[model samples]
Target: MTTETSPDEHQQQEIRLALSEIPSRLEALHFVTADARTPATVPNHQGRDEPTSIFNSYSPHLDNITNIALFHNEDQTPMPSPDEIIISQRGRRRFNNGSSPDSGSTPLRMPFQRTPTKVPLSTSMILRSSPRKRLTMGSTPPEPEPTVMPSPTKPRQRLWRQGLPPAKKLRMIEEGGKPIAQLNEETPLSLLLQGMSQQQLIRLIVGDLVAGDAETELRLRTRLPMPDINPMEEELLHAKRQIFRSLPTSRLCKKTDSSAYSRAALHLNEFKRLLTAHTKQLYDSANWDALLDYVTMAWPILRATPHWDSATHNVTRRQCFKLLACHCLAAVKNGGPLLGMVRLQATDKNLRDWARDFDDIQSCQSALSKAISKGRATL
Candidate 1:
């Protein structure tokens, strides 16, 4: 056979021999593919050092493999199969004794006792798990130390009585309508006002007037004398200017804009107040001639002022006409026949239209007619 062999046959034979050596060279191949971070060696089931295979390094299904070649040479001991490598949930290596064939051989101390994790067990679980203790005849079972649950903390008071101003504190500390500790809650308002100086009392009164106390305001205005009309006219002109200026620059879809409406309302209210104060002054001073003329002048201006029902227009109109009616009645009674003729003319010209809406004005109109008829009859 050697004499008959050709160069091609010998080359083919050598190729098959090289192919047979590949399985034996797998460890060197594994070593080359592995990084320098590979662990050098690990203990096998026989307690002997063995090299790790490439499969052991990267494979997640290690437990499934039955046979694996992890040795560089045939003489070296084989690495433990995947079954012998028991990994716990904590990733610690635990060796199984049954992995070794020799049953009589002593097992190595593998440090397999896992340290338990501590958790907060509830009181009921602990009580159920605990052993029952017997109480002796002479001793009463120790009463469980009462669980002192902490009381709920109170919310802090933002406005305690002590935090009040000194004057306010004194006012709150009254007893039985008498001054205790300077002032008491039970004390009469008159007594309190008496203690205040005239200037202080006047300041308080003025503040109430400015704050729009209607009753107090009415009483005060009834006694107030009319100041010069020149200043009042100037104020009216200024208020008209402010009202016109307060109109919004933008076009609105509604009848009025809110901010513009509020500003206009304030100005209208001021205008009405001024007119009312002056009218009341005329009536209070018994100047019937002046009041009649003032009403004629003021009415047209009030009627001309721009206002929605939401503003003060309707209220001002009603109030102004009522004052006019009262003036006319007084004139018919006290102003004699000459003033009666003047009032009669004023009512027919200026107020007849307003009489339809206002009951008071309508009554005044009827009264004026009756008086005129009565004067004619007496003549």
Candidate 2:
């Protein structure tokens, strides 16, 4: 050169040259992007002074290459433009509408603020409900909850009315043939009851049937105290007699109506009361002889009573026999040699065969036999 160029002028000339190459480079980029699905071939757009090729020097994709720098090399990574750099420095950029970064119409965005939507609280709660957690691979699953079983309920018990005769033909409820005791006549009523607890008095009245006269019966019906009569074995015996007298005269059959069935049910109810209250007392006191006597008296009556009904099962009769067998079993286990004598008498009377009538009683009978065997061993 005839004249030496200044440093500032030289820089200005290089910038102009690079600016002039931008249009052609951009055109080449658009052409490559437009036909990106097909393989791109090198373009012949570079000037003779520029020896290197853009294809050999840079990646083909616009997303992988940036046009911000005036110079680039084979190993150089892409850098953001001025707008992208500014946005990136501020925060992550969000597009209001989903658009590519190359789209000129797409504006540089700041971080978006999430405003609350105008939805009801209930609706929002439903929408925001946490999703069920998914089990991951190789993780153990949760154990299932234990299965609860319902307990079997007892069958409904039949009710017995006061003073109702066992048979339609019988005129009145029998008070057994035994006379009411007059031993406590000199004692005050309070003193007579003083030795006994309230529970004992209640058991005597409700269970023992100590009341023998019409006045006593009336008071009992009215839930009044019968301090006049003392609790005695005589009253218990009379109650037992009343139960025996109440046994059904005939079995319930197809010809039997509702009213007849009802009367039979009442009789069974009385027998239940005898088993629950009076027999329990006899067992508790270890009154072996009296217990044997009642069993002897009851066995024949039970054998005579109706064991089945066409309209219903023989549950009541079966339950009564089961109670008798249970008492016998308890006495056999606890009463020692006395129960052996009772069992011998039962065997002579052929009463053990009666156990065959009820499944529950058969079980008790088996237990009774085992208990008797154990008692003999102990002796």
Best by lDDT: 1
What's the C-alpha lDDT at position 228 in model 1?
Answer: 51
Model 1 Cα lDDT, one tens digit per residue, 1-379:
3578888997777566555543644444444322323333332322235333344455443322212333333444645644444432236545656866874464333343332233343433322121222122122446788898887998687665775754443455346565452457687877767678857766777885546778878888788663356666666677667767766665643325455566567776677677777767767767766666666665556555655545443565566557656765675555444455656566566567765545676556665677667656666
Model 2 regions lying over 4 Å from their true place: 1-257, 311-313, 340-351, 364-379
Candidate 2 lDDT over 251-320, as tens digits, reads 6533244444565566567656765776777776666555655655565566555545463646766677
Native-to-model Cα distance after best TM-score fit, residue 300 in candidate 2, in Å: 1.9
Per-candidate local distance difference test:
0.56, 0.55
Q: State in Å the error of residue 251, model 1.
A: 5.9
Q: How good is model 1 by TM-score?
A: 0.37
TM-score, one value per model:
0.37, 0.32
User: Candidate 2 versus the native: TM-score?
Assistant: 0.32
